[model samples]
Target: MSTVIAFIVIFGALVFFHELGHLIFAKRAGILCREFAIGFGPKIFSYKKDETVYTIRLLPIGGFVRMAGEDPEMVELKPGYRVGLLFDENDKVNKIILNHKDKYPDALIIEVEAADIEHRLFIKGYVDGDEEVLKNFSISPKAVMVENGVETQLAPYDRQFASKTVGQRTLAIFAGPMMNFLLAIVVFIIIALFQGMPSNAPILGQLTPDGAALEAGLKEGDVVYTIEGAEISSWADIVEIIQKNPGKDIEFLVDRGGNTLEIPVTPEVQEIEGRKIGLIGVYSPVEKSPLKAFVYGFKETYMWTKEIIAAVGKLITGQFTIDALAGPVGIYESTSIVAESGFWYLMRWAAVLSINLGIMNLLPIPALDGGRLMFFALEAVRGKPVDRNKEGLVHFIGFALLMLLMLVVTWNDIQRFFL
Candidate 1:
């Protein structure tokens, strides 16, 4: 039950924020948004307001925004009307700009009153006398017609998407991922302010056999009062003292079971990631106050984000194994363990996971919000949108690869748990 609740809370918040991005940007772009729906498949419940239908679906996994003119088949156009045309769906009238074209057969006398701009559904008006007509369009009922013995149905909604200006459409695509990134930063800051942070303890908890602490005669439960004549309040202080005293003997004032004692110990040299630092084996006890908890929470959030990004980079560079990856089952089991630990631990983990979710969603992969933003950026740079069919195909390939990876990760999780 605890695991279920945690999953629901975490997934729900992450997904809601992601979709909320789309909803916000759609409204900002003055697009006719038909629906802002959370989750997928059949709607469980919904409400309509201000020309937008808000819905909760059965599956709590994903969401979408339905915008006007998003489909090409739906764009309606009238005959003999072409240049600088904008489709006004609300008005349902096509404005015609009459232009003459001299290239025509004498018998046909096809005066190009308006050129049917192939491959473009919408066009912008300029200062020139280039008149354009607006048309109504819809996408449905796929059928084929023969042009010069080649059968093709009107490529549905292909031209409609091409009509919008690069800047306007790029904003629509970028809004969602940008929102996720901002949410992560905000959550990290909040957690930093509220969560109990891990700090070093002044006293050594366990002295490993042959470790620096043991070699220095540091005993368990010995409260380190001073190092090198500097008063020690926390384990961090001890670390600072040792780090500065590498390969040097240090004087210590310790309180062991109410008895004060002074001892001299040589700091051991320890190499971490190719850098040598002084080491004294000790572990900090978890401590929390209301003020410290908040600060720790936010710090932990930021740290976790950095850790995940680093881990992903390592994985991509072959420094990490795919076996380290976790799927839904792994998360479920981990959440259960955290929930059982205690309230503060659970809260800390949740905050960390929230920040992780925010970062992961921002990765530029197809079938993800970030991936869509990449295409939008390209369109913005190239002065044109990508072919809708090609874009859809790329996303479809990404989705398939994601599914395969999920399956592998899920299998690994099951093996770790039940096996």
Candidate 2:
């Protein structure tokens, strides 16, 4: 149960930070973001704040920000179409009623001749069903239109994703993945600050209570020089020697305050990953430098980023099969395993996952941020935008393929872990 809660909190934080990046940059770019949603399908919870509705949906697969002008106009006003318009005190049309005109009895009924909601912001039509009486009414810049009993504010040309400069749009799309990387770095820094920077030195910091090391008189600050006549210069050396001789007595030559001491201890045998390993249960020394903590954060994040990139490169090169990929189920299983280790281990896992997510999202696969970036690059080269219909179709196909892939990966995970 604790592991489940940890997984949910970690996953939720990752999604929230990713979407928040898009929201921040989109607002700065003057785009009208109608909804900032987490997950897909039916809404489980939602709240409206300012210009955007924040929502959490049923599926926990992914999230998105719905920006205006990304889709076609919902309601179109054509010549000879009848509509009802409500006006503000300034005599500008504040609302256009597409349906349920009877609910707004005081609205002026008009047979639309022409309308330009984006740029000109005006409607010219015959008012009160009189064909001879032509009237032109200005629409408020913040005017809202009702369709099927729902009111949605109209998005002007300036407040749209497409209307922004290419640079702004690119940043808006890139920010989501960038924020994931930032989350990783921040989490790493937090871990470093709290736990100190991990060191590989063979010096002992703490010994497990009642464990072989503690029971055999091993003390903190004792630097192990050799184990059973074998040289130990690093923690890896100690681990290798100890793990190789489970349940066997080992001689430890240590330097405590420049005084040599020999301690004999029998390692407790423990099974890990289907193999028995010896455990003296001692922790390596840590560096408590505040500056080092910050440095470790960035260095750790960069290291994970490089490792993930290499793994992805291997995948593309066919060195690894699709079976290597893990979906939500696999992640949950990993989370459970890591959570059993300790809090710090779980945190480290989350940071690595965040970095992996950031790098994966940057892959130039359709329906991903990298895919949008690829389109933007082409637009810049061609000196014009791609045809909307063609681009939309490409994205639609890409999204379908991605969903199919996700389903396959999820099934594989379920079979591997459960069946």
| Per-residue lDDT of model 1, residues 85-184, tens digit only | 2123453113322223122112112113322223433323222233354323322222222223332333323323344566666666666655655565
After superposing candidate 1 on the true structure, give the runs of residues whose Cα lies further than 4 Å from its correct spot: 71-168, 188-224, 227-230, 233-235, 239-302
Tell me, by TM-score, which candidate is best. Answer: 2
Query: In candidate 2, what are the lDDT values of residues 337-415, reduced to their tens digit?
Result: 9999899999999999989888888888888999999999999999998888898898899999998998999999999
- Error at 208, model 2, angstroms: 4.5
By lDDT, the best candidate is 2
The local distance difference test score of model 1 is 0.64
Q: What is the model-wide C-alpha lDDT for candidate 2?
A: 0.91
TM-score of structure candidate 2: 0.89
> CA lDDT, every prediction?
0.64, 0.91
What TM-score would each prediction reach against the true structure?
0.60, 0.89
lDDT at position 407, candidate 2: 93
